[model samples]
Target: MELIRAIQLLKLNAVSTAWVDAVWDCEFTDAEPLDSTVEDEIKEDVKVFKKVYKQLLGFSKEDSTQSVWNVFGENCVSVKSLVAVLACFVLGAKAKSSSVEQRRHSLQAAAVYLLLLRIPGSVANKVFHQILFDSCLDIVLKCWPQSAGKKRKKETLKSSQGDGKSGKRPKPPKKVSEEMVIDEEDDEEEEEEVYFSAQDLLGMREDVCSLIQTLLKLLENFSLRDKPQSADSCVRLFTELTNLEPLVGELSFSEKRDVDKLQSLPELAYHGLWLLCSSSNHGEGNECRRRVFFTDCCTLFLMMRKERAKPCLLPPSQAVCNARDQAILFISQIVDEQTEATLPLLKILIQHICHQIVEKSEYRASGAQAVGRLVTKMPCQNYADFVKWLFNYSLNTRVAFRMFALDVAMVLLAQEEREADATLEPDLASYLSHRFLVRSVVYGRRSDVSPTVRAHAMHCLAQCLELPSHNATKWIHELFSSSSTAGSQTMMETGHSEQTLKRGETAQKTALTFRTIELTKHKSLAVTTRRSTDELPLAAA
Candidate 1:
């Protein structure tokens, strides 16, 4: 109680180094162990710190007018001193000697401090913000569990180091005792059991979630207009958070409760980024800064997806899908509002999507949908570049991405056709009508390695052939001629080795012949020389 009174007095009087040192030297015990049944001294220390934190922020139940900056101003040495005291406790929570419970209390105190900092007219000093941000981020990262193999390796290395002594150990005798052999086997068993228990893992995840929630709240309240530097720092924090992965292993039956908890980490980090992007004020002369911010946001989004793809037992959760949709919606909204300014960021996002498609990531379908949405929002002039990119990838060597790019191109074309007023640049128009794209689609449909790719290519070819400006006469002729040549070639091969022809090959020939006949009957073609199969000069069976 006396300590609380001293903090209140400091609010009125000018704070000095002596008072700061006294506060730091106060007997605040570390948190108790997790398994302890009773918490006595640590609980009192936590309450005292919470009271002091409220006092420093001028958050009072009785007197609400008092403010921290009112006493020492925003940049005074006294404010820095007070901030340092709180930051010290926050950092101390990350110490190796600190138990999980101690870390939790320290983080709770930090959260209170950050929460109060959100009040208007609170301390805006850069030093004060940096100190708290760094401390909180450090503690959160340390508390987040890393890969199991990494943790085991670290423990094993520590165990191997013999009491930190530099000298080599004496060699064992040639004939070891039976007891010695048993002890060695027991040591191996102990090393193998280095993983965290269910209780410890649960506690660590709770701490991470709590601290991340606090940091996210702080970020939401951060005034980007006045604190650009702080905004950058928050961006960095979320970027790092997105890269954090869960423990690497299959979730045992005991650890199922952790699935949702672990899933919440990425969702929270994603929401923080979404908040940053949505709340940014894109005024005149800030285009460069806006670009950097949006780029970082996009990069962080991709990084979270990458981290989620790592080997873990956590199935693809709904939280992840919702987060992804939210991100796409956010980007789409920005592009819709400032298409010109956000074009570069859009390109970056599309590039990442293309990368995902190439890698056959599980999120590739969503990525393709994102591309389609963003492209629909883009201006006509910008369509040429994206069209060119899609066409190039439609013929990609990777069959899956080739199919994906073809689908995206088909969607873009369909959208353009639906928008009656949309105009394409002359260069793009000519390029789209050229024979190269037709040939690429035709090749994919006829000779692609995968059946799925071939099917997608067939659909995309139909869309291309339906374009009003496209002259299907040449492509139709080429398709029929190629079909004829392929048919004649198949007949010769069958005649040369009728017994060697595989059943799969024969079925493929039949399917290909039917697909060719279907294309020839497409209504868009005005050919008059349609020939029946019996009149095409093939030998009768």
Candidate 2:
């Protein structure tokens, strides 16, 4: 009730919400475990402060935070309301108490946590994904309605063969075995009638979406802000973003990538890659700031440019063009306009955009014009490895679609690829293995492409199977095994994936070397004495 009342009070003071937020923040901070003498004394002081703040002066003092905190601090512990609420949720996450009261309080805390996430710029921004998901799982579990078994009707079967000498009826037909089947069906229907309260489930998905939007929005906000607001906040938000990579399905493309429609939404289309692309307080302790910003921007540009699941349903290439201009602008801002030198990561990320359009994007163009665009802007650095990976992943499979005609393949061939030799000194085979493995699983197997491409796809799947789980194979298996259509032209399905089964057999045998287990004959994991670990949590925000 205290939690509910405090939240309500803050919500009701609509006009002065910022001041309220600031005050609540202070109270939250002061509410931390303090001296016994100070704790009791603070309550009285808080009472006096609230009385003076409301009844007299009407908040004449510019410094309202001190008095406001003095009032709320008497009861609360953290200065940041959002963080204070999250701490409670962490309790809920760890505990297993069955008390109804605790359940209700935990649910309320979860609700409050969501509201703060929707209201952007809150300091609790980092854990938005974590809180949202944790709260969602809890809510869903509680929201499942209870049901009861139906009472069976008493029935007797008449004897068909009643020639008994004693005139006793023949044994009843096995307790109405045939008739009992009918009763079971009726029971199932009744059980399914149980329903969760709509008022409780209302806007659940919307609430979830709003939090995701805020997380995506922070990319832009942090990029534009004068400085990284708080290191703790930055760590939390981006860490949440990183953690969200696995829940990609829940955060998938809606197959609504219609160009005009996407153009209308603008920034909304570039939601995924936007965060990692931009920088905050560029000269901070983290040295990768400028490079990360550019690399992420480049990745975002390519993803947006690519086609989504449904045909003609993706953001306009013009949006990519706009972002490109923005990228150029950002580049000029971060690095001196005079410096033509580009980092290797940025160049790779940049060239991939063109790679996606010419070789990978589903949308069609009159010619392979996009290929020309990709190479024209290439830096002096060798990008042959990136080109080869793009060709193998995007062009070699039907899962990848070219935005332009294959007739222009000759021109693309003429364009320079980063040479596989002597560049960066990393094993090309290993990198190729990872790239192909992800491509195979992420896109699923395409039935429309040629056998050669399928063979190449199989090769990549084999590669993932070979690498350590710390490497490509584990992630590839997950991708190929996903039900998301954004991974390919359509949903790859949810149950056992044939792509995984067949390819996995091939991959496993080729890798591990001790045994030759075929990838196609895979089965459910064998149970062992050791408790099996559940799937790792993925970040998707």
Candidate 3:
């Protein structure tokens, strides 16, 4: 009766830590075994508790309405009460001698409770999240205790065996005096940590993963229907979790290679990617949030891709590539929506696109298209900043990456003289026509070691020369005169070299004439060609 009263008070938000602890103590410390009658009583209490929770939230067993969901953020339950309940649930889960089914029920109930409270989700919905997400993560942090306990027990047993082998037998001690000392030592040495098997860890992980996946799915469902504000809370929660430095370090464990042991880690990753994919499509108003999402997605994509390519282990089935594609698509969407990409974001996009271009990945074209579209639409200052950043970045990075950056620059430079409308700022035009840049690209074409890089640099230089601000005759002359610098031995024999220029010295002139005619023919048509967001292609199968 006392436990029931305490629980009722908790439902009314009468948060008292002492009362919560008392109730847990009384309920879990009952001396009698859980016979059918006691189990029936506990089940009835759960029913009553659930009913009271629903009632407090202005919901009913059969009632389902958005208005009812709105009550979640109304603070019907005080923060302290929510924390107390969740703490109690965590304690129950970790309780000594608790049945597996009981612990699972406790965790599941707590998860449902948290999910319900988050239904009125918003970016600022931290009241329930701090208690719930933090508490669940705390549970994960406690998982090592089981393994620790096993080690301690093994050590203690070994020590006892050593004592026995030494043949040291002491006189039996008096019951009241020496017995107390032994009892004290025994008590201290007893299992202070939770004792769980490998199966238990796997089960706990599955539960945690399922709870997170379900919560994200709920948010995704809300987002699909345009309820972004409701979904934003989940986004904020997940973003916070993912960005936590410790979480990744903990998940990337190499000690254990068992699939079941590490399966939950990948599952968490997949669901996180899914949430990112969904959020990217829905939230258009929050650029900062989207930027963070895409940035993390980029990092995750690289990690997942690298992990998948290792010959020893297969990546999570279908998920790595699917998530990667979704991330690329999201980048494309951001390019279409935002007026300009930040320098960091631009660099990441360039890096990712460059990899795709080099690998001939199906998504290569999509990434290239996104870069071109973003560059063309960016403000003149931003475009100039990006071009300068790319120039420096290419010089510092790998040769393959440098080629891609140059490809992006070439796409941006492939424009005719502005007629009446001036999108390119004056300083930017001057910067684009810098003599040093033109000469570096010319040098790259004539003498770069990698044929692919040279070919890309050649095309890039040609496009730069075609720009209205550039002196075409000077670049054309440089292109023709620099032919002798090309490696005759490497260029002549390699029939299928990705080299843009052929062996003959006359080929350079022909290439220049061909490029000039092509640029002139398409310059007018290219100016009017705008890529609509709807026409953005997906990753090719």
lDDT of 3 at 14: 38
Query: Measured by TM-score, how close is model 2 to the native structure?
Result: 0.29
List residue ranges in candidate 2 displaced over 4 A: 1-5, 8-71, 74-86, 90-202, 213-272, 281-343, 346-541
Which candidate number has the best lDDT?
A: 1
Q: Model 3: per-residue lDDT, tens digit, 328-402?
A: 444444445443433334444443344334323223334444566545545556555556555544442245455
Ten contiguous residues with the weakest lDDT in model 2 = 523-532
**Compared with the true structure, what per-residue lDDT tens digits does model 2 show for residues 459-524?**
545654654444454455556555634654333443123443345443343233211111122211
Candidate 1, 115-194: lDDT as tens digits: 54655555554334544555565566555544555457458666755653657784433563331121111222232223
Give the TM-score (vs. native) of candidate 1. Answer: 0.53
The residue ranges of model 1 lying beyond 4 angstroms of the native Cα positions read 1-43, 53-64, 70-78, 95-98, 112-132, 144-233, 236-271, 278-320, 337-340, 361-363, 395-404, 410-416, 420-424, 429-541
lDDT against the true structure, per candidate, is 0.48, 0.34, 0.42
Kindly report which residue pairs in candidate 3 clash with one another: none
